[model samples]
Target: MSGFDPRPLLGKALDQMGELITTTDDSQRDLPTPCADYTVSQLIDHIQAVVRRIGAVLSGQPFWSVPQSIESTDWPADWAEGRAATDAVLADDAILTREVQVPWGQSDGAAAAASYIGELAVHAWDLAAATGRSERLDPELAAAALPAYRAKVPAEPRGGDIPFGPVVEIGDDAGPYEKVVAWTGRDPQFAA
Candidate 1:
């Protein structure tokens, strides 16, 4: 596994997501995102849930026991709290060397963190696209996540057991954020 510390990339991706969450108005909650089944509100809750899971694994808690669904009464606050806690856990250098039980199985912390970063980045793009703020997402963050997606997330045709759907086709000239989104099974041209 790559020994590169994913904290910086993860932080950037989470920060991008935080920005998206902060700007989301209540009227846009029902909008459809590129995640296929999730509406804007549901996607926000899912992001919070995933962040909580990351924190649990990092803290040596039983990650599998964490609830997969988080309520969305006050998403910004909930996301902020989860982000702070997860960020604290990720800040530890030793986490990169330890093994963590991820949804796919056990993996070294570096790989696990990288996978989360990729997941968050792609979802941030989805939110951006749904909310008509796609231009606001950071291309640098998506570029950084591509290597992790390539190394950790399989490119094979997606099945029921896989978290992502089949990868969508994109042009060779597609930008970094578009490539990242398409790699995660979203069409870059997705419109709400």
Candidate 2:
């Protein structure tokens, strides 16, 4: 499915996170994650920033002409609001396949959608782990995300300054959730 459109996956990722964030207890906000330096709050904020940018691009607005760092505040709520914004963008026909310049480079609607979906799935696992939640990416969503993630990584041979070891080797018997987490650089077995 090289020609796969990423909108459905993007929607699914948003739905998954929206459900979890709504239900997560406020007390679990301080847990750690496999995303190295990020705490639960920071991860949530990062997801929000990325989603917001995607929404802007999809709406034919400028993306980050003046990118400012955000302080971590009201993160869970930020995620919910950002998810709504991203959902709005995905539903907007004007931006989805329209040629737009992204922060990384120039891309069409399909590439942008795929990148956004793949990013959301990765961070959802980060949030799930930090919150001690059982949420997982849909199998089809995870499968759709792999190629996009791989494309984002540089092709330099392993053991460079990039810490990513390899294309995570997951078993055929592995569940979809595990595969997704592992592929995204999260240790599937991490516990808060």
lDDT per residue (tens digit) for residues 22-101 in model 2: 66666766678777767776666566677677777777666674142344466567777777777777876656568777
Q: Which candidate ranks first by lDDT, i.e. highest?
A: 1
Q: What is the C-alpha lDDT of each candidate?
A: 0.84, 0.68
lDDT of 2 at 66: 19
Model 1, span 2-105: residue lDDT tens: 65877887888888889899889999999999988899999988888888888788666666867876877898899889988898898888888788887778
Residue pairs of candidate 1 with colliding backbone atoms: none
Model 1 ranges with Cα > 4 A deviation = 1-3
Error of 1 at 103 (Å): 1.7
Best-matching candidate per TM-score: 1
TM-score of 2: 0.79
**Which window of ten consecutive residues has the lowest lDDT sum in model 1?**
58-67
